[model samples]
Target: MVSPQVTNLAIILVMMQVSKQVPFDNPDVLLGVRALYILSNLIILGIYLYIQGKINKKRDMTTLKYVEPAPVGSGEEPRPVTTTVMEYDKQQLRQLIKTQMMGVGMMGVMHLYFKYTNPLLIQSIIPLKSALEGNLVKIHLFGKPAVGDLQRPFKAPQGLFGMGQGAVKSDKASVENAEKNWRGGVKEE
Candidate 1:
């Protein structure tokens, strides 16, 4: 069975191929197509924002339960930190939404610009549009949910480019040795 992603990609490719064959000689047709594309993107953006709002509301309604540590040497059972649980941080949510909106605005502008001069270029943005609308891009970009596995501030993996295990020190030593050799040759001359 073909995966949905593959199917979607294939469909897009076919559409692009078909569009390339058709001559867009009529300015009215081109304008209409551009308008339709922009309208579709606007609708998608609206739906995406709506879904994010709903998700944020649901998340805000959630409570974080905290248990107090037992007193030292008392062995008393720990009590709840407070009767009320903390809601999701409003500032973080606002930042996340802001980031998403920025991405939407940027993409919208690019799409609008490209749809007129280069309709084919607009096709390249389909995946980005889908990802943005689905909120997948936001999670990675904004680090939303702040506490879960998908939390923000991803760390770069170690050992990139073979830089692990005192590689920098060794490189410095090698460079110093080479410099000394060059200086020694100059002195001999």
Candidate 2:
């Protein structure tokens, strides 16, 4: 016999896959599809949280490679600045990953859940369509990197995740703030 969690997980997964196959002409069908998508996120998040706790009891290693820094300085020539990092132990890494995973996944679940439940949330949130035409709104949506600026213009449904993450940011604010502060916030910035 499957535990309630496991059964629910299965249902969520099946619905998620089925939602992909469904046509989206009818509003009811579209709503169902949206619901399944939300359900999939919740299940994924639930499983992530479940595994996160278990992972906490074991070793979880994270290897951070030096990524290119945001371009800094002015004038024609620019230089790169790299930060020093150390190798974290497996257990410590796992704990960190677990903590981060649960934080991000849970917040993501909540964000999508709210949108799915409340139609007015997006409508009320997004300013006038004309407002989006301004550089300010576009910059908010696309973003301008201060140092190594490289954010791209968001494209429709593909950009939804970024939009959702932005909402998450407004609730919490800074990336550093999110990392050290929030009970459930992603370390990915």
Candidate 3:
């Protein structure tokens, strides 16, 4: 449930500490590893885009509309309103794909730079980046359930040894509610 910014910051701090402790001077190994990472990311990105294309094709062939309840005044009765929603228009889909491609490109650049400067830093960030990309692909292309536990802001750990029971309980409840409403829950007027 850690925020991405916080997680990134922690990764950088750990990388700095580890780099100081274990200095790596082998450029050949770093380059090899960086190349492998970039190749793997590109492969995954290609697959994600392919799947998204298929999904968008299917969506574009369909016309979807739904009825939503209109807001009612204190003394009025609720009325249902029909709304037409283009879930995956061609332009929007293209834009989404472009954005994801840009993200992958940026990740590749950052990772390669970090690998050369501080080899240890790239290790921590790679898994985080992969998980984020996987989540993005899942939600957009595969229609898979998201990890609802991360929707809320993280509470500072509080207790003896920083293992707080109150925070755990609240976090658990919030996660449950989030899971229940994961797929754009029903709107109440």
Candidate 4:
């Protein structure tokens, strides 16, 4: 659909061109004047809406009335809010925003980070991380360590201990012995 401004612009250009081409004695100037008058009315309406729209912000009853009652008053009335309800609403808003930003209690990101990046920690970990990694490597076709994937196998140590030194010894072990080690059995000499 053609907008009012565009229509006004076209009328102005038409009038300018017509005025230049037609003599002052030409009868067709009346037609051009009529077009200019129509365009002026459109311009006036556009300006009225653009300038007065803020004060004219009337709530559309057709859209809002079915869902929520028109905030209980005309624009002139000062809507009163109870302090308790106000505070409760504020708290709810704060909680909603906090949870939205922080996520489902940070578990979404924390779990992913822990899963992907097996970085060092101070806690004592399993006793036989090496043996476990070795068994994974032994059985695995690529001979890569475990802790990553079956094919690529993670470079990160599966356990919290030895900074991956354990996976080295475990890799050389026979499959039966490796299996026992992986089950957390005692490492016999």
TM-score of 3: 0.42
> Which lDDT tens digits does candidate 1 get at residues 1-189?
643355556767877776776566677766665666566556655655655565555454443333333455675443332222113233334554565566556656765656443443344356335545233334534445544333322221224243322211113344444344432333333
User: How many clashes in candidate 4?
Assistant: 5
Q: On TM-score, who's better, 2 or 4?
A: 2
Summarize candidate 3's per-residue lDDT along 1-189 as a digit string, tens digits: 654556666777777787675434677856665565566556655765666666555553433222222233344222222222224333334654576567656665765565444543454355436445443445555565534632212232344345433332233444444344435555345
lDDT of 2 by residue, 74-111 (tens): 32211111221122222333543465456546545654
Largest TM-score belongs to which candidate?
Answer: 3
Indicate whether candidate 2 or candidate 4 has the larger lDDT: 2
Report how far residue 29 has shifted in candidate 2, in Å. Answer: 0.9
Ranking of candidates on TM-score, top first: 3, 1, 2, 4
Could you tell which candidate, 3 or 4, scores higher by lDDT? 3
Where is model 2 poorest over a 10-residue stretch in terms of lDDT?
149-158
Cα TM-score per model: 0.39, 0.25, 0.42, 0.18
Using alpha carbons, what is the TM-score of model 2? 0.25
lDDT of 1: 0.46
User: Each candidate's lDDT (Cα)?
Assistant: 0.46, 0.36, 0.47, 0.32
Q: Residue 184 deviation, candidate 2, in Å? A: 34
Clashes of each: 0, 3, 0, 5
* Model number with the top lDDT: 3
Clashing pairs for model 2 are: 60-94, 70-148, 71-148
Model 4, span 1-189: residue lDDT tens: 653335445655665565465553444754454354345444433433332332134221221100111233343222122233223223333443453334323433543465311111100011112222232223322334323333221133333333322222213234335444433555578
Locate the minimum summed-lDDT window of 10 residues in model 4: 118-127
Off by over 4 Å in 4: 1-22, 58-189
